[model samples]
Target: MAEEQMNFQAEVSRLLDIVAHSLYSEKEIFLRELISNAADACDRLRHAALTQGGLLGDDSSFRIRLKADPSARTLTIADNGIGMNREELIDNLGTIARSGTAAFVQQLENKAEGANLIGQFGVGFYSAFMVAEKVEVATRRAGEDRGWLWSSDGRGAFTVAEDADAPARGTRIVLHLRQGEEEYLDAQRIRQIVHTYSDHIAVPVVLESKKEDEPDETLNAASALWTRPKSEITDEQYKEFYHHVGHAFDDPWLRLHFKAEGVMEYTGLLFVPSQKPFDLFHPDRKPGVRLYVKRVFITDDCAELLPPYLRFLRGIVDTEDLPLNVSRELLQNNPRLAKIRQALVKKVLGELKQKAEAAPEEYANFWETFGPVLKEGLYEDGQQRDTLLALARFRSTTREGWVSLADYVKDMKPGQEAIYTITGDDPKALAKSPQLEGFAAKGIEVLLLSDPVDDFWLSMVPAYDGKPFKSVTRGGADLDSIGGGDKKDTAEAEQQDEAAPGIDALIAFVKLTLKDQVKDVRVSKRLTSSPVCLVADEGDLDMHLERMLKAQHQLDRSSQRILEVNPGHAMVKALAAQVGKDGAGGVVEDAAWLLLDQARIIEGEPLPDAVAFSQRLSKLVEKGLLAG
Candidate 1:
């Protein structure tokens, strides 16, 4: 067949340009990426061979072969696995056919530094360009006769042509080294790189002898890292294995390795990443833990193996009890797998509990990254709700860092009966909420929840310990009963109430004027600084929940909220006096609406009628200025 040349995809061209110009700090990663791809191809063939006969052909032993030719300035990585045909070559190599390609490109364009784009985007094949001036891939897919050659110069174009002399049953990638990249061609350096990055790979990585007199060397252990004893593994080995299995750049914050020797036996080697995965919140993202039955590859994604809340975990679960040919559907209904999942959850949660107790500061950092994800269990996994709640942490009105439910309970005021919380889109803004002012003044801490998941889980988890969770933005705070208040402040508030004799009449007048827009208008015990604030009625939805539902289009309209006026504020006192004299008409009517709109704006709610609000504000401002 004739050679066909094609321009790279726009994203791929951008990627190649960055990569060829040394996008990565560590050039040795080129070998790691190639080896990982080679190992994946081998694993695929091994799995396919179970159903299809003769896929492996004569090369039943799957291995990755590496040859370095210093004389020719080339290093070759070859694998006898599931190599690609012409179309597969083009589709896989010429495009970034993955979700979040646009996001990846945007981040790159924004100069995001030290990113593992190759691993994160499934474009590891292109990393070869980091160290090579040119690359050539020659391969024949397993169980197919035709072969193809793919050539690229890392200059935005690649060519694919028929290769009569391609490998019989796999791929062989040759990297023509650029000047100063001679380290990759050294046997010792090649061995060191493989030991550092690809040692955990299950496939054997063979390094060809530099001289005719020596035998070819297998640089890796050629066995699954999880199968080895935990005592035999070092921390560096664990980290390298995590990078290989997780396809992640960050180190593992926590590593769990254990063997379940009970009725349904399995071995699990899981790592909790220090950094969140790029697709952790993607709707289609599933757990990346590979499942192997008796060391035979089954599938990389088995959602049934772990609860979705623990989806951030990355590694492998190899079971002796499950069938090697088990399909995904079968895995879902498998009782033994369910048992394994339950046990794994318990084990992980227990380890986390220990870690939280031993090293709280470190665990707090982990919680910052994965706490929102772990909170999903409170809503979805009923059996583990208590454990998840204990593991939870939050920012609070009184504290600078994360506080646990246990710590909050311990620090509760003498007469406090509930776990107070306030939900919003931002913790910093929530801290400044007028509704929290009275609580803050009384030294009562309220939990500040910022994650969207906080809303869902708060509904499922009604309380922590024996204290019911009460939103500060709800009508009934009963702040009078909570002890710990400045006696002088109480006396001053009482004095203000006496002096502002029109406050009750003003509340009644405002209530009648804005009856259609508000559930009720009343004086607030929760307001100390702001003139007014909004809160949900006792039986209505929480203000934050209502706003969130409306924003998501899940709810057509928000529940009416109570408008609470601060009796001590100068503006409120003056408005009350005006209402007392004018009796609920003209200027008082506009003031009533303005106060409601001001409260809404502070609460992050949009005005119902912006034009009317503007007109009323201008009229009021003009009247006040002329009087002054």
Candidate 2:
């Protein structure tokens, strides 16, 4: 009977400070936020029938309407779906954050995973405060007939009044655009925003556009894409939807058209883009999948709709069942939502495995652009690691190209029990490593890894299929023991270290002198001709990655790496003999420094002591001339 005025919750004021100033990067996000909320209500109505039909109020068709008042400079978003009551209006708007919203957002920021927070909120409704000087939320619950209007200036408090004639079952939000924001009242502006961000929505999103005969005509597909059969939607239409919904120009590399019918009725049309979206790194990039309840547009707020790793994917996910709110808090906990997201992930990955097997080249390009992100799965999601792994591709030791674990498994030696790999900063460099010389001689292939994310992925994807992944640099290289045969050069190195005048004792002497920097100085077990090599201590961080992190974070100091030496090479042999002659001979010390420096150079590393290295180089050249 009477309008009631309410005070803003203590947190509401604090939240207003953040929503207006901090929450979003652009003021336009308010439209996205509000529009998303309206869509969620429609989606919830579409699905509520299966669980408890009373919540939807017999409305089968749900749509969103956009209206503008040129003279008043006002825009309104109205939906014919489930609406909220007085308490809901206050909880949604009067509080800075409901419990779940605050907790999830805080955890993300704490974990420094806020880079993908866009659309992961219920607070998105508050974004309207960013552009509207005056805002009104008029809603009536779907099953109930009475309506209430809550209006706010977004300063602190709000006013709620009874609405005698609130249209049908949904909520209508009106925004009095700020002076400079009056442009949003333009028909063109409205169409642009809806088509750019809401085209693939499962519900109709109508914008007022000028027509020849009528003053205004509804413009936009405003239709659910996934609800339609695959026969009706063309590939070009699908691409357009991807570009519009994802703000991505790259055409999708793969499209997964699926309908999960038996247990849960849902239709999903998802696309794997050929490239990462421009804002893939932005913390506020909106989720590309639109959520629908029984084909009615709901919310696109849950990045959880698709796993965070698949945040780059774009498409529509229309389900007959899911909660109707745009709040990430509810979506995260909702059993139906969690199930759909999990199923979607498996389906996408399974489709990927199919692509990797059926059309290897296409999936290869997809992997190249998205591999590091997918590798992240190996560490974070062990349950799906093997499945995601079946789609992985890598460079082979014997080939100039990439190979899948499946292919490698097929190529393995009869007795080989593990999938062997070697990681370094440079793939080409690892390929040339003396450690691989013995494997090559024995016809064993090692996967070449150059990505910084390689080790991180390897750390997570510890095993592939039934075979475990073993880093070749770690241990049990045992190349000499393998195949019961050795390369001619390996044989010579073992012989050279043994028969070449007093070499075993010399090696021990060199180890004693360089033990501080050297791990273990053994006669060449892997190196055939290379004089010296560096191997990471078994299970320690590999060389290239250590270097990468050091340079990436710009750490002031770095951990020293272990140096491995090749015993058979003449340089090593000569150094050993010289060390045997004089424990602290000036020439021998110089030779020791040279041996370490030479090993560092071959690994593409700068010398730990560069100036001293230059001096040693000069001495070594002089010594050669003096000998001649």
Candidate 3:
């Protein structure tokens, strides 16, 4: 057969134009794409050798080689894998040009987020145009004797010709770096990109030997980091892989790298980033935890590798036992892989618990970054829930920053049957909660859980130990009135409130007046100075959380509140005196609404009806002056 030369299809021309011009903002990413393609080729050959009887035959220092010539302004990336013949090249490249263009266009329209589109779609080969004026791929299939050359200027046309001197079983792509992009022709630049994006690539990546007296200094570790024994690798090496795989440099505050060889055979090198990345919340952030089959790169998008809640983790997992073509969907059930996944979950959580136990301060930092993430597992992961609960940390009524369940338990007051908590959006407000009421008098510490996800995690875990978590604002927490416990001071306060003129009658009046807005109004068993505090009906959502959910558009409206009043307070007495006065409707209603307004404000909630709250407060002051 003879060689063939033709122009690119018109749409291919348009796609090439986009790839070269508007597709990628950082042309350097083209190098990453090319190196990734080379790594993928090597991974295929490695997998085939193991499963498909060595299509590559012998000669197994499997690697990708790079060559650059500054004078010629050319950068070449070569891979010794299952190379393509002319037909394969045309199907892979030309197929995209003619039919794949629309798919890529649709993708561009749907996700116009950032310019990291090479890995997002399967057209990474065309990304060469971002920096190259022309690209040439000379290749030979591993089992074939014939060779081929595929060349294109990326203008919708390409030429396929016979090659007498191509590698016997490899593909070499030479990129003629354009104008300002010619710097890529520097061997040093190529080496940097390979180390960053393709370093952990199961096989070695070799760069051309530039020094006359020495061989090529391999730019990457070239060895799989996961397969190595845990003791032999330093923490620095662990952190480096974390950065490479995660596109981050922050040290990993915690790491779990090991191989499970019993029921399943897989090596995992995972890291917990010391600080959360900016894209931690991005819905499209690529999962960089690569999957490998016997050191052959499979896919980084394998959600089965780790649950979505643990997406913040980064690393590699190389498995020697799985089939190369394992459909990602099948990861859920492959018993061996599932076993491996289970081990990984245990290993990560165990490491976190060990860290928190070993160093409280370091664990505090980890909590600040990932505690909420860990808490998420409490609700979603049932089998792992117990471990995550033990690993949980919190801020309490007593601690400065974070307190573990163990620490809170150590400080539990004698005879305290329930661990108490008060949930409000603001810490300071909750700290002063009149609802925290008698709990403070008993000298019992309460956990101050305030994150938006607090309610969700708390729902999963009802009790830490034998003590059930009791929300202070619940309507009927009968905190056995200071009894013989701390009655000295409470008794004195009770006497003072009782002696205050008209106090008992006023408590009755405030309750009757605010009946419509309150669930059930009663004299406070926990009142100190404040006249009234609102509690939610027994077992209702925290007042602050209900409002927060509504603020985030998660809830429609707030639940009603339980209003508790101080019996011995003078204001309750004064308001009580005028309860039955002739034409006291406007004056008494104004005073009741004003008390409700002030109570909600102190509890860190907004008046639901600000206009009415204002009008009522104005009238209260006017009526007081007329009485004077």
Best by TM-score: 1
Instruction: Estimate, for each residue in 1-628, the C-alpha lDDT of model 3 and write its tens digit.
Output: 4668776655456667667675665667676666667766776666556546657666787887888888788888889988888889888777553334564454444334325333444566777888888899999988788899998888777889889888888799998878998678767777777766666555677788767887976777777778777777666566556655665535676777777776577888787887665445555544557788876767778767777667788888888888876665666567776767777777887888788889979888888887766677887898887788788887777668887777777777665677677765657756877766566665667777766677776667778777677777776766554233466656645564454555555556666777777777677766766777888887688776787778889998678888777665556656766667788756766777787887888777777899998877778777772244
- What's the lDDT of the predicted structure labeled candidate 1? 0.87
**Candidate that would win on lDDT:** 1
TM-score of 1: 0.95
* Tens-digit per-residue lDDT, 1-628, candidate 2: 6999988876556556555554554566566656766766776666554455576555676778888887887899999877887777777777644344454444434323332243333355666877788898889977776898999888888998889777667899999877788878887877777766566565677775545566554555666666677898777667766654554435678889899988887888888888665445445645668776665456666666876667777878887776444454767677887788889989989888888889888888888788867776776777787787777788878775578888898888656777888877667777887777657766777898876668777776657778888777765466644453346754564564454555576566656767677766655566667766677767667666677777878545544445555665666656555654543366666766677778788777787789988897788678772253
Ten contiguous residues minimizing lDDT sum, candidate 3: 109-118
How does residue 81 of candidate 3 score in lDDT? 86
Clash count for candidate 3 is: 6
Model 3 CA RMSD to the hidden true structure, in angstroms: 8.5
Cα deviation of 546, candidate 1, in Å: 2.4
Cα distance off (Å), candidate 3, residue 18? 23
Residue 120 lDDT, candidate 1, scale 0-100: 61
Write the candidate numbers in order of decreasing lDDT: 1, 3, 2
For model 2 the TM-score comes to 0.65
Q: Estimate each model's TM-score.
A: 0.95, 0.65, 0.71
- lDDT-better candidate, 1 vs 3: 1
